[model samples]
Target: MITAAVLAALAMACAMGAWRLTFAKWPWRAPRAAILLWQSLGVTWGLASVGALLAYALEPYGGGVVYGLHAFVDSAVSFGTGHGLLKPYDLPRVSALIAGLTLLAVLVTVLLAAGVQTLRARRRHRVLLALIAHEDPGVPGVRVVDHPGAAAYCLPGLMGSEVVVSAGTLSLLHPDELTAVLAHEAAHARERHDLVLLPFTALNWALPWLSVVRNAHSSVALLVEMAADDRARRYCSPRRLATALLRFGTAGAVPAPDGALGASGEHVMARVNRLVKPGPTFPRHARVSVITFSILLSASAPLLWIYPA
Candidate 1:
């Protein structure tokens, strides 16, 4: 019975995580703060799922299954009754210890997951920033560095990567259009899209079975780009930006560095399409729904413990 409950809980947690990650409306326009929150929830859900899986594996009837097994076990082990898994004499100390250990485990898991990722990101940022600083010279506010590659990239940090606009790209875009391109790259650096993406990417890599996480990551990626585009539009004419996107699409300049933010090859067409046909405004209700769902999912494990089935 414990095993069945654990499995059901695991399934529920996974489903909930998936939905929270992937079900956003107007995903591209979502605020940076909101994306951060979504990624945090995803990490929390993944952690809870891991805990539930551990519980399931440790449960008895490890290799056997029976219908209504969980209910039977729960009935047989009713906590206040003499027939329960914890007898009156065993209840106090054992239950207290188990509860204490579970709390500790949860704390350790959250810290480990978040700490490891934070440390790695800090290390990578330090290394990447030093490399970019050494390689590129700059002008205040905005300056373009010439690099001989098929790649377009914006390095973003305290000492951000010099916006590397390839020579081929200069010929492809008109002057005002080029400004839009630069603005887009600047927006990426300013918003720190890479940092925002880190947790979601980690979740996707860690929990590949959750297709919803991958979808969420993809959606977030697309949205971040759009959000950057919107920022670019604020400085440059949207028509010029749209034209630049078209030209860049035609020029086929690939994105530089696995880590840099730019309209990478994979999503160039989608981006151009969006530029040409921008979507309707994101609704407040959609944001509320997404946030509400995330809150419920994040609370699920604790809720289950409080009101055990």
Candidate 2:
């Protein structure tokens, strides 16, 4: 039970830290590293929370969570034969076991459900695009949809991902700006940013009462955009990207379609400002320290779960 208490406390701390991180400015300087930290925090919190309940519930079986669970299961299997018998579970322990299992089930169910919904939406959009969109020689690999509203997004897929731009965006942006926008969308497709957002979406659905989860979702999303911008800068000058973002912000741009990654979505003005007056890069030592700590923190959850108590 002491180990369970410690795991619960760790989960609480992670939750509080996630909430505070949403407002921190350091993430803007090293969005990639910050994203890693965010993922670690979220994973650790979930693992520790579930581990706490299971640890407490299985405490009477001795050893750690895994061994205790194995012992419990073995005893249950041999109950009728009166072989490998263990003491019966009290009401509190039984309740804790059920609750832990239920929570685990809910998390897994929501995660899978979110993935399926996203896949279905993407498939629908892909079919629609195939029928209505046409390739433009000027843009090479990009598909141009004949729409008046400014739009730029990527439909990520396993076979082949595609970047799409509306006719209005082509009309509004200069050639260099167009290149930057395409690069931005390409970064999203190449990096599979949609996958990064999936767990957070599932977490939010599973735990809507926790405002921290919602804030983390929004913050991670903005970081993903910033990370994509960083990648886009590798292909085109920041100035061109900044101008394109400004146009998108001011031109009443259409939001990205469902299950698609947008080039000019999620705090466009903030992205533009970032490009216009870029901040100092995070120190290498600081980034290394953060990454190392995050990895250790994530590892701790499983270690705690399996360590003999």
Candidate 3:
């Protein structure tokens, strides 16, 4: 029971931390590291919550949750008594076990469902693109759509990724701006940003009413765009990308297709500001500290399950 309480406290703390981190400005400077922290908090919250329930369920069987669970299951299967597992099972413990397993199943089911849905959406969009979009001699690898609205995005696929731009985008931007947009979209493909955003998307879909989930999804989405922008910066000047983003923002360009990552998606102004007037990135010490904390946080839930009270 003590272990269960500690695990529950840790889960609540993670949720509070996530809520606070959503409003922090430091993350904008170190998007990648911030993303790691967010992922850690989310995963830890889920694991610890489930661990707390399991701990409560297996408390009568001595040992830790992991060992006790094993003993309990073995006793149930073998109809033998050992490791203090001979005690009659109570209603509360059985209920806790059922609840914990249900929650775990729900989480896994939603995540997998989200992934499948997203893949299907991407595939449908890709097929649509194939029928209407065409290749340009000048933009060798890119697919050019004849739509009048300005848009640029990448479709991530198992076979190969596609970077796409609209006709209006070709006419609206200068050559340098176009290059920057292409670089940004290419970065999304190279880095597989879609996968990075998948978990948050799943969480959001699973718990749409939770503000923390929405914040996590929104913040992570913004961070992904910023990360892609950083990668694009390696190829072109920051001003070029910033200007292109500004154009996209002002033009009210059509957003990328569902399940696709756009160059100018989510909080475009903030991304441009970061690129135009760069802020200080996380220092080596701070970066190391964040990485270490993330590792510890992720491991804490499992450790609680394995170690006796």
The number of the candidate with the highest TM-score is 2
Candidate order by lDDT, decreasing, is 2, 3, 1
lDDT of 3 by residue, 127-246 (tens): 899899999998889999998889999999889899999999999899999999999999899988898899899999999999999999999999989988988899999999999999
Error of 2 at 180 (Å): 0.7
TM-score for each of the candidates:
0.61, 0.96, 0.93
Judged by lDDT relative to the true structure, which candidate is superior, 1 or 3? Answer: 3
Best by lDDT: 2
Query: Model 3 RMSD to the real structure?
Result: 2.4
Residue 77, model 2: Cα distance from true site in angstroms: 1.9
For residues 192-301, write the lDDT of model 1, one tens digit per residue: 88777766666566556867767877877877787788888799887787777766666666655545677554566666777677788667787787677667656665
Worst 10 residues of 2 by lDDT: 80-89
Tens-place lDDT per residue, model 2, 1-309, is 888999999999898889889999999999989999999999999888888989999898878788878888888889857776653368888888888888888888999999999999999999999999999999999999999999999999989799999999999999999999999999999889999999999999888887888899999999999999999999999999999998998898999988999987778878888998999879999999999999999999999989886
Instruction: Supply candidate 3's per-residue lDDT for 196.
Output: 87
lDDT of each: 0.59, 0.91, 0.90
Full-model lDDT, candidate 3: 0.90
Error of 3 at 137 (Å): 1.5
State which candidate, 1 or 2, has the greater lDDT: 2
In candidate 3 the C-alpha lDDT for residue 82 amounts to 38
